[model samples]
Target: MSVSLNGVGLTHANGQVALSGIDLQVSSGERVAIIGPSGAGKTSLLRLLASNLRPTAGQVSLLEQQPWQLSARQRQHLRARIGLIHQAPPLPPRQRVVTAVLAGKLGQWSLVKSLLNLLHPVDMSGAAAALARLDLADKLFERCDQLSGGQLQRVGIARVLYQAPELILADEPVSAMDPVLAGHTLSVLNEEASRRGMTLLASLHAVDLALTHFPRVIGVREGRIVFDQPPATISPAQLDALYANEQLQVLPAPESTTQASVQIPRC
Candidate 1:
């Protein structure tokens, strides 16, 4: 399936245009990274694809279904086929990690079964397996509220991993973690998405991370997609254009000028 956004624009309640005249496409099994400075509308783009927000103009389609045209039931069905990892892991605070992971299966399970799980809590074996994959097995029975930022994000990923959606949309999924954990999490996500042949589109702030993991990269600036190209082929000049003042500060400044200019590999 393909996620296509054509001339899509989104506006905020305060009359700010979050995204405008954007045209992008993600084919099945393509791992794309959207990279840009802060306030570049990365989250906005993700919301559009996830159908959490309707486009102010133009069209957004996933698997050939127009999001707004679908009935409530049909929308839910379509949403079930798409997995999203928010920048902040939004799990129920008091819910156990296993329960949070099991929430992923609610779409596939019957309503009665969903309600029953809410009460008795079942199917933890799969959650345990996913936790093991992320080296979070020890935290399975722990409450989501008690976990650290990184742990909460892992719990979120575990849920999506179990859901096995055809499309995965991640917005700064590793922003809260240290370099080591961030790399580990992203590697696991990218590997699993590849193994399952699912399309993965992730928004990222780390330039090298996106360059290292994703073959294709899209650069957003001021709510517009400024550049879309292969990571390896993207020039520093193009990066400078996208980030401008922001890029000079973040990118390797030149070996002679300052000690911080050196490139440090991060997770």
Candidate 2:
């Protein structure tokens, strides 16, 4: 199994219960999408899988090893095999795209080599090739701040692709892109995972995109797994119940505008 979460639960320091009773198992090369309303614990679940947040209850097994049981150095080594694409990538604003992408392998490189590479990118061609996969090859030398939001998201993904991890976790990766670009970006991610037999799990608010791109869909609501089924098997009624909010019904719908808005999880 690429990931296994058994009866997993997390409680924040401030007493916020982010997740509870999350039992999930994903095999190698499986592409899964997590969807639900905002504040429904989607991000928390992804963070749990990425080992960024430890569950206060239950066990988390990644790549057949219990993460919490591992030593700090061992955990660091394990993290090198996982790739996380963030919603807002934490790239340095003034850093060049090539340097940013190459930093993906810093965990695997020697400290001396990593510091040297920071001064001058060692694998320019590799970074460029990764960027080319996302149609951002032209921005290789541009500062990260120069790119648009969608472009920065792509750069984050390219960095992960360059890392070539065994498991890929993404959170709202395409939220900044247009519908067409979002579709294309997701296709690239799915294709890469399929080609390399890597495990992929992503949390998305766009219901249509999730259904279209991923074969298996996991619905999370109120910090629990409501349903885990194939895309075709997920019914509209289930989605409605997952995102239902009484407050929205009391309000009137806004007038249609020419400018398109990203698909929000409907209630």
Candidate 3:
């Protein structure tokens, strides 16, 4: 099993409940997409899986180990096996793209090697290859601040690809890209995950993108799972209920780009 959550709950220090009773399971090499409204606890779920957040209740298992149960040092080692891609990568503004990409392995690298590589990248070829896969090879030496949002997102993905972790968790990874590029990047992610037999779980705002790329779809709403089904099995009525917003009627996840989008409220 790649992930297992049993009645898991998370309440922040501010006392805002982000998730409650989130019971989920994913097999090894399974690729799943999480779709939901903006505040539906999608990010919280991913953070919980990434070991960035501790659950307030219930049990959480990642890669067969309980993250919170382990010692801090042991948990750090466990974290090295998981690749986390954020919506906006937390990279230094003045850092070069190569340095940023190479940092992906710092978690697994020895202290001396990590420090030396920070000063002078030891494996420029590997970083370049990863960037090349995302069409960012030319920007390798450029500072991160010089890149566009979409470019930065790709850089984050490149770092994960280079890291080669057993599991991948991405949160709204392509929100800044154009439709076509977003589609392409997702295709790349799916391809890489499949090729490497890496388990992938991504929270996506683009419902069409989720339907197009992922075979399994999980619908989250108001910190709970509304439905978990294949794209073809999901109904328009179910979607309408999941994203019911009182303010304005809006589009539900379309079956395909060619199909007319379903009408619902804002997610």
Evaluate all candidate structures by whole-model CA lDDT and list the values in order.
0.85, 0.89, 0.90
Q: Which residue pairs in candidate 3 have backbone atoms (N, alpha carbon, C) closer than 3 angstroms, thus clashing?
A: 250-264
The best-first sequence of candidates by TM-score reads 3, 2, 1
List model 1 lDDT by residue over 22-124, tens digit each: 9988889999999887889998899889999988998888978898999999999999999989778889899989889989989989999999988876787
For model 3, the stretches where C-alpha displacement exceeds 4 angstroms are 246-260, 263-267
**Candidate 2 structure quality by residue, lDDT tens digits, 160-258:** 999999999999999999989999999999999999998999999777788779989899998999999987666656766887872222122112211
Model 2: residues >4 Å from true position, as ranges? 246-267
Cα lDDT of model 3 by residue, 1-267, tens digit: 999999999999999999998899999999999988779999999999999999999999999999998999999999999999999999999999999999999998999999999889989999999998888999999999999999999999999999999999999999889989999999999999999999999999877788889989999998999898888777767766777763445564554522445544433
The CA root-mean-square deviation of candidate 3, after full C-alpha superposition on the true structure, stands at: 2.2
TM-score of every prediction relative to native: 0.91, 0.92, 0.94
Q: What's the residue-level lDDT of 221 in candidate 2?
A: 91
1 or 2: which has the higher lDDT? 2
Provide the lDDT at 227 for model 1: 88
Answer with 1 or 3, whichever has the higher TM-score.
3
Best model number under lDDT: 3
Q: Ranking by lDDT, best first?
A: 3, 2, 1
lDDT of 3 at 102: 94
Which residue pairs in model 2 clash with each other? none
